[model samples]
Target: MTAYIALAVVVVIVIWAVAIYNRLRTYKNQVENAFAQIDVQLKRRHDLIPNLVEVARGYMQHEAQTLEAVIRARSTAVSAADEARQSPGQAQAMGALMVAEQALVGQMGRLMALAEAYPTLKADARMQQLSEEITSTENRIGFARQAYNDQVLDFNNEASQFPDLIVARLAGFAHMEMLQSTQNEQERAIPQVKF
Candidate 1:
């Protein structure tokens, strides 16, 4: 009878371990999936930058500093993504990437506003195409960022919960930061710009 009880206890422990293992794996997958969404958006932005620079060059020849900033920022942003190929575990590494990403976003915003300064560029066919691409890509980025944050939130909750947290700690569950958004999420509810 005692032998049977020991066997039953061992079986129960094994089953419990497996259940916890699977739950943690599911949460980790969610985080990876979220980052993948972010990757697609970032890649789109990277691909669009060259076209944008080419389109704006003719009309904005006099605006060399602005053009240079856009190129420099894009380069840095792309490099940063490469650096963060994995979800960053170190705080400083993450911070550096965030700074680069924000710089890119700011530079892109400035690029769009450049349309106001260069009337000729605004009217050019290539510039117009670039503008359309920027607008579409920006909308997609916003969507993907939102999705990533949502996933992060779900993962975070699981990592912090009662029973789940127990498993989470054992499974190497460290908190992942949500996309550090500038605007309040509620304000980005539309996620699109008309211009």
Candidate 2:
């Protein structure tokens, strides 16, 4: 009787561990899939930028510095994105990507604002089309980013939970960093209106 009781206990423990391991694996996969969605949208944005710059170059010839800044920012963003793709959940890689992307956004904003000063550039059909495409891609990226953050939150919660934390540590599942908004407090703050 004592032998039978010991065998049953061992079997139960094995099954419990296996269950926890499977759950953690599933969450990790979901987080990766979420990041992949974001990557797709980012690629679209990156591809559109060069075309936009080319179209704007004709009318904004004197704005060489602005155009070059945009291109350089794009290159940095692409490299950062590649690093993040290799290790989606790693803190350092994600932080680098966010910083790179923020710089790209700032550069792009400057390009567009300069374009606004050039009526001919704004009126060009190619520039308008490229701008629209970039705007659409930006919206898609926002949605994908939100989804990625949600998945990260779910995975972090599961990995850090009581019983699961033990399995997570044993299985070497580290906590993931979520992609936060690149905006600073000033950007997020509401503006005051005067009548």
Candidate 3:
């Protein structure tokens, strides 16, 4: 009777451990999938930057500084993103990438403000189309970032919880930081440009 009870206890413990391991694995994969969504949107935004810069070059001749800032920011953002891709689970790399991304967005906003001064540039069909596309891509990136953050939060919570924390350690599940936008309230607000 004693031997039978011991065997049953061992089987139950093995099943529980397997279940927890599978749960952690699933959560980790979800985090990766969510990050992939952000990657796709960021790639779209990066591709649009050069076209926008090229279109503005002709009209914003005097505003070369602003255009250069945009290009420089884009380069930094791309490099940071590549680093994050190589180490997605590392909070340091991911944080740096998000900070770079926000810097790029700020430069883009500055370029937009400069473009506003050039009525001709704003009126040009190509510039207008590019602006619209870039705006759409930004929205997509925001949504993707939000989804990724949600996954990170869920995973973090799971990893921090009592029983799961033990499982997480044994399974090599590390804590992840949410991909955050460093935009201030003013930066987040829409600029009201008068014609």
Indicate which candidate wins on TM-score.
Answer: 2
Ranking of all candidate structures by their TM-score, best first: 2, 3, 1
What does the lDDT read for residue 140 in candidate 1? 78
Number of clashes recorded per candidate: 0, 0, 0
Give a tens-digit lDDT track for model 3, residues 71-148.
999999999888888767579999889889989999998899888989999999999999999889888988988888
Local distance difference test, per candidate?
Answer: 0.76, 0.93, 0.88
Better of 1 and 3 by lDDT: 3
On lDDT, who's better, 2 or 3?
Answer: 2
Best by the lDDT measure: 2
**TM-score of predicted model 3?**
0.90
**Candidate 2's residue-wise lDDT over 45-158, tens digit each?**
999999999998889889999999999999999999999999998999999999999999989989999999999889999999999999898888888999999999999999
What root-mean-square deviation over C-alphas does model 1 reach? 4.2
Point out the higher-scoring one by TM-score: 1 or 3.
3
